[model samples]
Target: MPGNLKDRRGAGRHPAEALTCFCRDVLTSLGVPDEDAAVVADSLVRANLEGKDSHGISRLPIYAKRIRECRISARPDICIDRDGAVLKVDGGNGLGQVVSYKALQAAFPVARETGIAAVAVRNSNHFGAASYYCQMACREGMALIATTNSPPGIAPWGGKRAYLGTNPVAFGFPTRREPPVIVDMSSSIVARGKIILAAAEGREIPQDWAIDEEGLPTTDAEAALRGAVLPLGGPKGYALAVAVEMLSGVLSGAAFGPHVNNLYKDGDPPANVGHSFILIDVEHLMPLEEYYARLERFIREMKSHPKARGTEEILYPGERSYRTYMNRLREGVTLNPSLKSMLNDIGRACGVNL
Candidate 1:
C-alpha cells in the first residue's frame, strides 16, 4: 500500500475523503432519498474499509448511470409480509442494501422471539456484500447467513453455457475473544465484480479464473467478461451456487441468471432481482456464552497448530479482513486512476466536486 498510494497515474485520492465524497455526492445525484442515500453510502464505505475493493467505491459509476436512466427507484417503498418464522419483502425497486437492512430489522425481533427468522427480498438492486447485513445479527449474539443471486456469469454443472449467478453467500456468528466470525464468498472461482474492477483497470486476468466463449480457459479480461466464471470446487461449488439461487432468487420470486439485471448493461430494466437472509438466535440453540467460548478454543487451536513447512500459521477465514480494516482505516483506502476519474465526473455532474 505504501507504493500503491504513490502510484500517481491511478486513483489519487485519500480513501476516507474519497469514500465520503463519493457517498454524499453520487447518491444525491441519483436522487436517492436523503435517508436511504445515507444508508447506501455507509455500506459502500464499509466495503472499501474492509478491503473488499471489488464491492466498494468502484460501483458508483454503474449505480449513478442506472439512476440517470431511471431504471432503479430512488426511494422505493419497502414492504414486508410475515409468515410465521419467515418474512417476505417486495423492495419496490429500492436500493437492495437499504431494503435488506429494513428486512433485517424486522427479522431480528422475530428471530429473538421464535429462535430463528428468515427474510426474502425481491425487486431490488445490487446489495453489495451480504455480510454487511449479516453482521447486524452477529453483533446481537445471533448466527446469521445471507445470500443473493446475480446476472448470468456461472455455468451449471454438465453444461457450458452460463445459467447461474455468481451467488454471493455470507455468514457471521458471535465469538467472545475475537472479532465476529464473518465470511463472505462467491460460489464462482472468482467474483464477477472483481473481474469488472480488473476490466475497468485494464488488467489481465488469470487463465483459471474464467473461460472464454469457446469454453476454454483464458487470460484475457475482455474474453473472461463475456464468458463464464469457473466454479470454486467444480460441481460442489456449482451445486452450492444453485442452492443460493433457489433460496435467494426463486424462493423470493426474484429473477435469476439471464433474468437478473446487469448493472453494466444500459437500456435494460433493473433485471428486478431478489435476495434472502437467515438469522438464528444462538441462545435458542445453545447458551450464547458457551457457543462463543467453544469457538474461541477452536480458533486458538487452529492458529497455534504446527505450520506446514514454510507456512506461518493456519489463518482463520476472516482474520485477514479484521487486520485490513484496522490498517486501512488508519492508512486510508486506495482507488485506481479510472475509479478516481469517474468519481470526479460524477461530482461535476452532481455539482458537488471533491
Candidate 2:
C-alpha cells in the first residue's frame, strides 16, 4: 500500500454518531432548521459509514460557506407540482440533501397508488449520493432508479475540454436481506469528489483517472483537478452521462452542462443541479415474499458460483458497503490528518466543538 494510504488507515477515528452530531450542530448554527440540518448531517455521516469519505463530512465546510453566502437557502420553500404520476419539485435553491429527501418523500405515496411514479427536481444543489435516495425508496418496498447532474468536470468522449458533469446513476431494490441491493456509480472512472479529496490530502491519484488541461494524463491531484475526469467505459460512459444530463438537467428544466455553477468555487452562482427519480412498487410486479425469495436465491447462486485465484469471495453491489457500514458502526470511522484539521477549523469558525 502507498505510505499515504497506510497513514490514513492508522488515522484517528471518531464514532459515527459524534461526527453526525458535530455536522448537525455546525449546520444548525448557520441558520438551517434542526430537521433540515439533521437530514444533511445524517446523509454525510452515512456516506462515511458506507466508506465513501469523499462525500462525507469533508463537504461540510463548503456547505456551510455556501449557506452563509446565501447561495444555498437555509430554509427553502420547496414546492412540488404534480401531474398524474409525474411530479415536479422546485427546491427553492435549498441544500441538495434536504431537497432530494423531500422530493422522494413526496413520490412514495403517489408510487404506491399509481404502481410507478417519477419525480424531477430543479434548482437543487449537490445531493450527497444518488444511492441515498434510492435506498430510501427501497426501504419503503419500492424499487428506485435515480440520476443527477453536477457541475462540469468530465469532457465528452473524444474531447479534451469539459462539457459534461460527472453525472451519476443509481438503483436500489429491496431484498430479504437487511441492506437493500444498491448500485451507485458516476459516469466518470471515479467520482469528482474523490479527486478533490485527494487534492485536499495532497495525495496523488492514479494516472488513468484524469487528464491535465493540455490533454495529458497526470497523477498530480492538483493538475488533475484543473483537467477533466475520464469517462468510465470510453464512449459508453460519455453516452450515459449525456442521458443523465438530459433526464436530470433538461427534463427538470435546471441548468445543464457548463451552465451549472461549480460547487467548490466560492463566488459563483447557486449550483442549479438537477435530479430525476423513478419509483416502482415492487408488489405490483409480484408478491413481495416471492420477489424477495427469488432475489435472495439469485444472490446466493452468484456468491457461490466461484472465486478466481487470489480472490476471497464474490460480493454483489451494495454488499461491500453494507459490510463497511456495519464495521464502521462498531469500529468507528477514520479521519485522516488533513480532514481532521479541516473539520477542526470549521468547528472553530462556527463556534462548535468536535
Top model by TM-score, which number?
2
Candidate 2's displacement at residue 45, Å, is 0.5
User: At residue 191, what lDDT does model 2 achieve?
Assistant: 98
* lDDT tens readout by residue for model 2, 9-117: 4458777888999999999999999999999999999999999988999999899989989999999999999999999999999999999999988999999999999
lDDT of 1 by residue, 274-330 (tens): 888889999998887788778999898989998989997688877788788777777
All candidates' lDDT scores?
Answer: 0.83, 0.92
Clashing pairs in 1: 10-337, 11-336, 11-337, 261-271
TM-score of each: 0.94, 0.96
Error of 1 at 306 (Å): 1.8
Give the residue spans of candidate 2 off by over 4 A: 1-11
Candidate 1 achieves a global lDDT of 0.83
- Using lDDT as the measure, the top candidate is 2
TM-score of 2: 0.96
Candidate 1 residue spans exceeding 4 A from truth: 1-13
Model 2 pairs in collision: none
| Worst ten in a row by lDDT for model 2 | 1-10
